[model samples]
Target: MSLPPPPGTTASGGVPLSRRSLAPDLSRGVMLLVIAIVHAHIFQEMVGGDPQAPGAAFDAATTVFVMTFAEGRGYPMFAALFGYGLARIHLRRVAEGQPWPRVRSLVRRRGRWLVLIGVLHTVLLFFGDIIAVYGLIALMFAGLLHVGDRRLLAHGFTWMALGTLVYAFLNTLPSFTDPAAGGGVLTGSPLADMVTRLFTWPVMTPMLLMTSVFPFAVGVWAARRRVMEEPGLHLGLLRRSAFAGIPVAVLGGLPYGLASAGLWETAGAAETALAWLHLLTGYAGGFGYAALIALLAVRLGDRRGPVVRALAATGQRSMTCYLLQSVGWSVLFAPYALGLASDLSELGSVLVGAAVWLATVVIADVMRRTGARGPAERLLRWGTYREPRSGSATVTAQARSGG
Candidate 1:
């Protein structure tokens, strides 16, 4: 139960956790619901669901709403926050007069641990884990820590274009022809599914890295400015982005949602191109959702009541909460467990995911009041901070858990 250093504060300087920015953690907490809702559908698809399969009108609408609001939006938000969290660590360590090699090694160490955690997560529970991919991306971007914000943005946009083109090309083909292949292995033994994920990691890691670069880099840019930490300083930009980014994102997702819901169907290059359109819009939607959340956090300020507090607490323990979702899904849906995957409708899964997410929030809120670190967060802290001084923790526990 070692506490992390305070957010927006330095170790040597002794900034308290209360001084930390609520926007990032708050946003992450609120967005976890989005992540859970979106991924619930994905988990079903993994266990041999055709979300596009015929269902009731309500199911179709529920599924479509999940796509339009949650799917592509959630991961990118995490990507941005991931880079932002790493950058916060980098800044604090550098301020503490730590050498460059030491900082780089520390970040790399954390990245590797994330991969290990992700491996366990993928093997035992869901095959849709992103932490491993995010870890690899962190490793790749570690060397780019000193790149200027403009340069980072340029590189991010470049990678975004490359990722879109690459994915669009793949989407034009069959769905599983690419990194989408591994989920189908679930039809066999769970051991077989785990084996498939292990084998596919090599390929999927790079693809995930590519698609993730844009948001990660954008996160770097935002981190440099402490945008979320001090959203009030950039209120105009945040407002415009919220206003502008949402509609484009929602509209962009409409076609994909329709396609995924079977309200519209197409094949060949046309389908691929439409998929690309979704990616393009979805990326924007991710940014928009983040901006909107930041704005909401700013408006709520220090006066947020119980709902907000619980969400912020969940956000603080996001890793624990995130892993809990997979745990819940596994118990409720896994073959060796309850095996309800085939039983729940697409809409049903999303509803259950929301319920599970809410339960995790309650759990996280309890953890917060009791000053308990998420099990994963504590482990990650120890793994990344090997040369600990008087305390034990990592940047995430501070930024994420508000330690």
Candidate 2:
């Protein structure tokens, strides 16, 4: 299989950068770091004793931070980046004169790898594997690739609204019958729970799908419209989105965070309502965060900023870093590993996450200097292209030569 043009390489073999180049990648890396921190905190909370019960001061403080930062923002940020990546991939294919069918094939292949990684992640580590969700979304996106950017955006909002209604309706079911009946949250065996989660819990699978898909679709729309490319021109939209999203996120998010900590258990209806609000606010917050970062990247106009560059490197090898994160977390938190989850307070978990993030940034930076793609990324590329191992050397050489 032939390799696509290298970063900044045009279809005609020129080396001019695309308008969307660098910033989104760096942004995604930063988002991933946040995601890692959030996951660490959530895992800690899940394993830690009941937050409402008399608990250790450390645990209480940790839970508060996780509730405030990790749970509320991490996943949404990841979803937005997913959308952006989807859009970027499609745009790249179109520029290369590749048909949607080829892009679809590529997405399908990539999805398979994602599913494989997610399955491994779920079985051996955390059950909150998002790759499966991404894989499913990829299939849906394949068909939607033909839609214009406006149509994609419209459909995304439609799904978001419809998903919100569906989730709210589900949450309103009778107390005994509600899927979130036990502690007003879903919990059970992993495999069985996942099945129930996919079908019964509208909020779990459907909401996740909707949330993931819309941001991705919006990212695609942004790409097509060159919004990130022309950040200055889109400053008004960015500011408006941030302004509208941040406060709403804080309001909705705070309640949801409290509910998650068992603060609103007695007020079941209020808790349910907050859950719906959180969904909306979380998305808003994610968008707000992305907009602010994008604006900064544009203003700074420094692709080599330490933070920006670190994230960009991570994004370039995201698949590897993502899996590595899962492995690291598993080893740090799993029952068989350090068992840190059971012992860690929210704050402790955040510290662990920070350490993990720093480590990954360092590793990514090292890999970037060496011009080596992350291992998982290399394998995924090989799988997607059906290329032989020997081809890797050629690819690496080309990459090093600034292909």
Candidate 3:
């Protein structure tokens, strides 16, 4: 597989190098879209009416399916891609003769922006904002970037293990201290929960930060090694990573899922051990997810097929689409809004998510036709360049210089 030029670099005598505007971005967008569906369902399940007093089995079942497929997997994909994008940016800067130190400043700026976005998302939109965590994790990327690939991979696994141990130990604590402390579905006023999550849930922020950093670090390692850019060199490693990741994900996910639903009641030493095991497995699974997806993107990207193109479009504008989902769902489901939150089942929510994804596709398609970038992308470009709007000629020239 051929590696595309660094994000902002030109090819040869600069006939306006293709922006590697291909599959990965689109695939990531689809992942985010699916994630929104799960988020919507979860919000409803928690706050929509009482599940115990439910008059809706269908809704409940839909919720189960989403929980099964999306909860464990979706964010990992996003995290991995975040890493990949970070590496790409780093490479582009290096190609432009910028020192790597600039990455620190960029990460800091981006992290601050991410934290702001995440805070707003939690307060006004969704409480499970990953951006804030991502922002925090971005700080570590600069340090991690300097590490050799072997060390980076080793450190990634070490953190995964340590994080799991910490998580599992905490999980088993209540079992020892107060076994009767029932795990209730997290619900209540969004405002109340938001406050609690921010202030009381000590694990929330750290977990978010870990989720973002682990995958991102891996992405940096992979990019430095040119793994995605030249897949053939790493196919063996990729395959092994996938093989190891799948079973680990299953083992980790099973107990965690059961624990979520109140299946495990006892808090023995064994349970503590298993809890740590689950945590490690989950992180491994996330890495596996990243490797598998990156491999797929590299292998299939060159074809530029229709599906690939569509996915690429979606990925390119993921930030816009992600925010759009939040806005759309809020209008559709909020108690003060459309109030569909109480109306749809989990399964129905998934369908609604599909509908939302389709809507984004349509919008993306329309924008592409008009030679338009997503609004968020456009704004980011403006911020990056500190420039006014320009015609395609100017864009082509910019492209020639590797923007």
Question: Ranking under TM-score, best-scoring first?
Answer: 1, 2, 3
Best by lDDT: 1
**131-205 in candidate 2: lDDT tens per residue?**
767777876666665676567788888877777656655644675333235321223343554454344333344
Question: In candidate 2, which residue pairs clash?
Answer: 62-346, 62-347, 83-216
TM-scores of the models, in the order given: 0.88, 0.79, 0.76
How much lDDT does each candidate structure score? Answer: 0.76, 0.64, 0.60
- Tens digits of per-residue lDDT, candidate 3, 1-403, equal 1223454354321211145534346557667765777777665665454443333555544544453445656676677667776666656655655556754555555666666666766666655667667767766555665556777788777766676566567656764234233212233355654564465334556755654555676777667666655566677887887788866677665655554444555456777786566555655665565567667776774676666666667777777777778777767766656767666655666677778877887677666667667876564444333323443343344433435
lDDT winner between candidates 1 and 2: 1
The true-versus-predicted C-alpha distance at residue 191 of model 3, in Å, is 7.9
Q: How far does residue 280 in candidate 1 sit from its true spot (Å)?
A: 1.9
